[model samples]
Target: MEEVIENKFIAIKSHINGAPIEFDFEVKTETISLSAKSKEVIVKNLYVSIDPYQLHRMKSCSSSQTTIYLAAPVQPGQSIDTYGVGRVVASGRPDFAKDDLVVGLLAWGEYTVVEEGRLLNKLDPMGLPLPYHVGPLGFSGLTAYAGFFEICKPKKGENVFVSAASGSVGSLVGQYAKLFGCHVVGCAGSQKKVDLLKEKLGFDDAFNYKDETDLNSALKRYFPNGIDIYFDNVGGEMLEAAVANMNKFGRVALCGVISEYTGGGKRPALEMLDVVYKRITIQGFLAADHTKNYGDFISTITDHLRTGKMQALCDISHGLESIPSAFVGLFRGDNIGKKIVQIAHE
Candidate 1:
């Protein structure tokens, strides 16, 4: 017999132009079947990732909406699909079964009925916590791996810089840089985060960006020999400063511009003359586009995480109801690592 269930999901109240409040989100309920149709799997979401890029979709801000299907504008009243960990409640697919753990593009809801099991894959926890699969072991780790290694093409003994060093991607980038024999420095918003970067994450040095009056001077102080590689998460003045301090033939992997996400920061006037004269290379990269590297990324990171050679940094909130607050907290720089919302118990 098929069981019917009430699924509570978060939806936007309206298109938000700037910072989002809890009122901007409303929990909506819908009834769903526990039984799945052909090629479909019904999943109960356990944990979901909270990211800044979703804000761009909510604002209809990302130009990628026209090109990249993932950045399509999220309309009011639509349940958001995000990277998450879930358990199959029912399955009509040959590959999945009831109680099998899975991960991929689940929803910000209690229950998700993945038609055709699209973008979904069976997960092997590798004896690690499930939330680990959501953050450093998932998209965030992949993003850091792809951007730093593939886009930047790092070499050993390089002087690497990571902005938002305590963040999901940046933290991992710093760790990876260190493991790869690079001298890495990072910037964070608080002294606590700075401490975490330097003491715990193996960063060669770290500083509170909030304490620096001039980022250019700060970069010069940290990288007296000039920066060889930069993994940029916070764009704006930091990008400008990095450009000014980059070594000749330096590489920058522009992973994100979180500073400008909410339309709050000043537009950066990047000095093209510096870029040209320094013969530097800057490239923007997305993890999904670099899927070919996933096998190596997963194997390498899983080994490090299991051996304690790499840290799986995560900040998780409980309950589906906390989703809105968790999402809003990203902009406030409240989370020290990957912000995740746990919807249900495993």
Candidate 2:
């Protein structure tokens, strides 16, 4: 016999032009079948991640427009989907069963029905917190790993710089660079975040960008010999500063451009002559494109996390009702590490 369940989901109320607010989203209820269709699975969401990239999809972009990478514009009434971790409640696939933990693109809701193929990875529960899978072991962690190692091609004893240093991806990137024997410095939006980078995450040094009048001078102060590798999370001025301070043959992994996301048209003017003289290589990459390295990321980061070689920090809000505030908080710099909403606890 099939069981029926009433699910509450967060949906966009309308197209947003600027920063997202709490009223921009609405919670709606829908009834769903507990039994999944063939090749599908019903998951009870445990944790859902709120990322900055999703802000790009909240606008009313053209249907034919595909400028935003790995994301599509969310329709007014559509449920928002992002990275999350959940437990299987019912399955119609041979590989999945009830109570099995999984991680993937889950809706911002208490429950979701998804095809088995959409599963990113199954959770192992290796005595680690469930949220760790979505934080350090999930997309954010993978982004850090791939961006730092594969894109940056870091060398030992090199000087590394990270923008948005206290962010989920940038935080891990700084730690990873430090582990690779690099002298790392990061820039964050707040003093507390800067302290977290230097004191908690072991960054060689970090500064609050809000306190710095001249970003270029700040970068120069941090990287006296010039940066060998830059893991760029925020674009615009920070990127311009990093480019100006980059060493010859320096590598830059352009992970994201959060500064231009919301109606903020603040694009920084870069000095092209600096690029010419430095011979800098800047590469923009998406973690999804590097899915082939997922296994290696999991194993390497998992070991670091388990043995305390790495630290995973998460700013979590409780309940599905907090989803909107939590999602909006990312833009406000309200989170320290990974921003997550805990829908239900296992």
Candidate 3:
């Protein structure tokens, strides 16, 4: 007889429209059998990623849904699936077996049943922490690598600017720019994050965007000459400022717009005249769209981490109970790095 497991997972009480509060989420319990069907696997989740983007998935109607199948919205009471690291407990799949460590889209709860066509694969920890697999070595790393090198296409000695520089993807992008010989500058919401970018992440310069009343002037101050590449994670005013300060033929990799994600910030009225006159190229990219570079990214980033050329700043909260608060912290600028919840200790 198969043993039944009581799984505690996060579910929304209602679809959120504005910034999510802790009250928006609730813990729900379910009973599952320790069994798997053919081509399916049951995984005990360890670390689930806590991301601001998850807010979009909780919305009743969001543009994110149309952009990618992964961003499809979930209704109230449905399990919130996120990228995470887990240990396989039961498997009917030939490639995966018991005790295999895997990383991919898993539920926010204690266990996830992965079926065919879902993103799940065995993970090689490479002597790094399991949390690293959830952050720097996982979704965040891929997003930074692809958006900077693939979309921005940086050049040596070029001026590179990153918004939300202290966060997961932005921090890695700044490090990669520095390693590639590009002059890098980053902006964060707080002074602590600015210092982390400059002192720890090896960025040439970093500043608190909130301190500057005029964002355009701030950009001009940082990139005195002009910016060659702009990794935009925060849109609205910052995007407009970056566009105004970009040099001719500059590239903008539109990653995520943290500013407007929850519909709080006003839409940016960018100067289209500057965009046209400067001949700038602005492109939006998702990490999922750049899977071709995954092999190279893992190899290169692993080497960088091993050699001390890169540093991963991760902020982790413990237990499934912390999921809601950890997510809400992103908007409050309470986290200095990647915000992740350690669901279970490995």
lDDT of 3 at 296: 96
lDDT of 2 by residue, 24-83 (tens): 999999998987899988899999998988877888874323854458888887878888
Q: Alpha carbon lDDT of residue 215, candidate 2?
A: 89
Mind giving the per-residue lDDT tens digits that candidate 1 earns over 1-346? 7689999999999898888888999999999987788889999999999999898789856675676766778999998999999999998899999999999999999999898726899999989999999999888999998998899898999999999999999999999999999999999999999999988999999999999999999999999999999999999999999999999999999999989888888767988998998899999888989999999999999899989999888999999999999999999899988999999999
Residue 147 accuracy (lDDT) in model 1: 91
**Per-candidate clashes, comma-separated:** 0, 0, 0
Q: Model 3: clashing residue pairs?
A: none
State the weakest 10-residue window (summed lDDT) of model 2.
Answer: 61-70
Model 3, residue 331: distance off in Å is: 0.9
Question: Any runs in candidate 1 off by more than 4 Å, and if so which?
Answer: none
As a TM-score, model 3 comes out at 0.98
Worst 10 residues of 3 by lDDT: 336-345
Displacement of the residue 327 alpha carbon in candidate 1, Å? 0.5
Query: Global lDDT of each model?
Result: 0.92, 0.87, 0.92
CA displacement after TM-score superposition, residue 256 of candidate 3 (Å): 0.6
